[model samples]
Target: EKTETNILKGIERMRRFAERFALAAAYPIAMEIIEALQRAAPVDKIEPAGSLRRMRDTIGDLDILVTSKKAE
Candidate 1:
């Protein structure tokens, strides 16, 4: 029983880790693209942070602007 619990815990941990890794790979370049799009535009309603999670009902991709506090 203890071995099964440990294995399940490890599998759950891997799932969480994989999610984070996928998001990390996607959000960096996505944010940069969103930033560039914002800079080139003349709109005032959307701010830097608001650029992400915009148009929730839109059919296309989410052009997000993500900010991280981690040190590289």
Candidate 2:
């Protein structure tokens, strides 16, 4: 039982670490995507939302808002 408990705890810790790493890794990619979108579209304003906006250590997904004169 003790061994099982230890293994479970280790797994949980690893999962949390992976989540944080993934988020950290995604920041650059998200920024690139946002930049590309701005360049491709006629955007006046672009802002990060959700976890990225909050500047959290870990993010599950990216949310962005864009405003453009071309948008209807």
Candidate 3:
């Protein structure tokens, strides 16, 4: 039935959303990663964006922007 198919589709969408967010790390963990990056190299600018920048309790993934003359 069309209704059943719609229900299944909704369930699938929720499952994908949960899977995407379930892999999040704590805010502290994300900070540790940022610190490590700072120590690893000297960039003109490096900062956390997205949820991490908002200081969310959980971070799905790190979104960093780095500027430097060296590509390496």
Q: What's the CA error at residue 13 for candidate 2, in Å? A: 6.7
The stretch of ten residues in a row with the least summed lDDT in candidate 2 is: 16-25
Model 1 quality (TM-score) = 0.40
What is the C-alpha local distance difference test score of candidate 1?
0.51
Looking at model 3, report the run of 10 residues with the lowest lDDT sum. Answer: 19-28
Tell me model 3's lDDT, rounded to 2 decimals: 0.71
Candidate 3 per-residue C-alpha lDDT over 1-72 given as tens digits, one digit per residue, 9 for 90 to 100: 999999999999877566344324555565687788788987777877886777765456668777888787
- Stretches > 4 Å off in candidate 3: 1-17, 20-25, 56-58
lDDT of 2 by residue, 1-72 (tens): 999999999999888776454667778988998999988988998888988888887877888888888865
TM per candidate comes to 0.40, 0.68, 0.54
User: What is the descending lDDT order?
Assistant: 2, 3, 1
Candidate 1 C-alpha lDDT tens digits along 1-72: 999999999999777555343444545666677677567665444333332344222122344443434323
**Candidate 2, pairs of clashing residues:** none
Q: Which of the predicted structures, 1 or 3, would earn the higher TM-score when compared with the native?
A: 3
lDDT (C-alpha) at residue 65 in model 3? 74
Error of 2 at 3 (Å): 9.0
**Of the pair 1 and 2, which is ahead by lDDT?**
2
Candidate 3 C-alpha error for residue 29, in Å: 1.3
Those runs of model 1 whose alpha carbons end farther than 4 Å from true positions after fitting are 22-27, 45-72
